[model samples]
Target: MAPAVVVIDSGENQEFEGKITVYVIVCVILAAFGGLMFGYDVGISERKHVLKNNYCKYKNQSLQLFTSCLYLAALIASFIASKVCSKAGRKHTMQTASNFSLLGVVLTSAGVNLEMIIFGRIFLGFGIGFAIQAVPLFLSEIAPARIRGALNITICETPTSLIERNKMEKGVKVLRKIRGVENVDNEFDSIVHACEMARQVKDPFRKLMKPVSRPPLVIAICLQVFQQFTGINAIMFYAPVLFLTVGFGNDAALLSSVIIGLVNVFSTMVSVYLVDRTGRRLLLLEAWEAILVVIMVCIFVMGFAWSWGPLGWLIPSETFPLETRSAGFAFAVSSNMFFTFVIAQAFLSMLCHMQAGIFFFFAAWIIIMGVFTWFLVPETKGVPVDSMLDKVWKQHWFWRTYMADDDCTTVVKVV
Candidate 1:
């Protein structure tokens, strides 16, 4: 029998030793550009293409499709990204995403017809699709656990790219270099163990369906769903529209909405410094929303920025073992984009029908999100990615029951 290389439950002694290099910081910042690109696509498609651009002339439903197809394309592309992340590696996959965005930009910029606009949106969707899935995984793997949430969560910002691949010796060397340490024996060993186990599984998607993998998968999907159900997209996607309802003039509404977006970015920057210090669960619990005026909108944006927007991507990134990191994130990203599309399509109508009640509608979901986080979500503050199942999930009160038999999952294969 080949020896089973197990990543034991983390304890104080398990901490990896290293200084986070400036090079790693720079790589994380680059990889985080995916966040910027994703925001740009989601924001610009609505603000520029559907509303501002003259070439988007169409009926209301067609215009809605025009706005939505990008997310639809993104939902489909995430699956494709899983394969690419496994084969091409995270850095190369991010480059490919940028290429798609560039092509989208070219088509949209020169578009004289609706088809060109749709094609452009589709391409941009593919760019962000591949980007959100790969970038978070890359950041989590490369960053030190102490600040992994800070670094990985930052990728939800304006835009970024990434580093490292899968060759064991080379991966270790790169890991040590980025960590600015002479020895990375312990950290690298855990990663190797995870990869070895990953190799025994032929289908990551099917494996994800098993009860053993339920905790991380559940957390990933629920966080994504809750992130959107908070109606941050409504506030984000239609801040200007919502502003207009509150009696701001069109110009003032646009300006105020822009302020809300800026706050979103600024608050996420704050999370980069706070997540590791405070831990992940508290950040989610701290979230709240308000809907009074422009000032209140900015406050709401600030709350979401620190909590779900970035943490949605951040938590899912760190939770998955490298074996299923790529594939698992693909589902998380798809859920996010799908719900985002849902909110985008439904918000205007919800606003029309619910009027002042829309705020109450989103408020109800926030209550449930808090309860869910308190009872079910495991803290991944400084846990190593490979040891997450054993250290975090298997130790949680609710999740521990589901993960009780998780130990038997080790698969043996000849090296």
Candidate 2:
């Protein structure tokens, strides 16, 4: 089993709790809003202010150019998010990202023409791109790993891995003949049994103590990147566009956008409350699946009503550990922006042109994400920083059933 973490609780400490810690939590809450603000700023900024009023004077190519500039900026910034996070650390990267976003806001507010607005939107995209990578990772790291996914770094199988695992478990009778093995079932069973035994014999403590490898570190980054590819950001970045496309007038559309922020805050609180209790993998599986369903419904409701307008509730509360938390978070955050860029700039346009296909290419991707998370993602509930990987690698089934006993909860001397 992974060891538990214990924060120091000094009696009558005067440094925090009353006012100081409140500010800290408040800061964290504000920091986390980089996503929400990105949604609000970039999502609707173009529609009411720029696209509707100024772009009318432009030629066809300029309108397209005007619409696409911010996306290109986001794509570039997202590519930089991981490297920046690794080099600058999470908090600093976030502050930088926020400053850029603020700058974007100022530029947009001051813009006198399409050129200035486009420049502002580009900066906004850059700010959001950086935030998507930094903020989620920041929240994931500072918050307990047991509660990381709830804060936002959801883990899912990479589809390819899940399929192989599923085949190994379920396709024994078929795969054996292809491999020319006469005892296919036995051979496969033996492999499964062997891996299980290895997992069982692997000492959680010993594995935890081993040096971190490059592969898991890379995996953490890739997982976060995949998260962005799911296309949640497409809806977020283009909420007003999507609403306007679906026939909502300007006033209702703006209100719809604000509601998204409200819903996100409320849903995130739910993750915060339940993250420590439910495993990250499980929460991710459920949330992604739910999001996927919502996307499908949106497709069905296309041109008629906006499905689950604005406030997204897909924060998966379970996948972070102190060791590589920032790197993993950076990857995931960047990936989301990258994914959103592709969806908004490419897929949606293609589907909109097609006229029959629902702009939900990302929905299928998320469903794949759900499948991967169900099998390969490990449980990190209540696991301490040092032994977190071990608890997952060891595949301890009994862990889910175990509770923190009072006698076992004492803090060990750090020696």
> For this target, which candidate reaches the highest TM-score against the unseen true structure?
1
Best by lDDT: 1
What's the lDDT for residue 394 in model 2? 31
Q: In candidate 2, which residue ranges exceed 4 Å CA deviation? A: 1-24, 49-68, 71-75, 78-89, 145-231, 239-265, 274-328, 359-363, 396-415
**Candidate 1 wrong stretches, greater than 4 Å:** 1-6, 9-13, 46-59, 153-166, 185-190, 276-292, 406-415
Distance from true position, residue 16, model 2, in Å? Answer: 18
lDDT of 1 by residue, 1-415 (tens): 1111225534332455677678778888888888888777656644642243222122255566776788888999999998998877777788889999999999988999989989998998999899987888777766767777787632221101111234666666675677677776765665566555667778988878877778889999999999999888777766666655555556766676777778888888888877702677764443322234766777778888888878888888877665567788899999998988888776776777778898999999999999999888878776656566666776888877776454434621110
lDDT against the true structure, per candidate, is: 0.71, 0.46
lDDT of 2 by residue, 1-415 (tens): 2112222122111111111123334444666676675657544544543245222232244444554566568767865775666555555667777788889889989989979988988888788777776665445333433433443422211111112234453345432322333444433443344233323423332322333322234335445445455544444444554555554557655665555544544554555445402799987786675456445434433311121111121222123332233344444444545545555455345545653344455557666766755554555455533343334433434332322333112212000
Per-prediction CA RMSD (Å): 8.8, 18.7
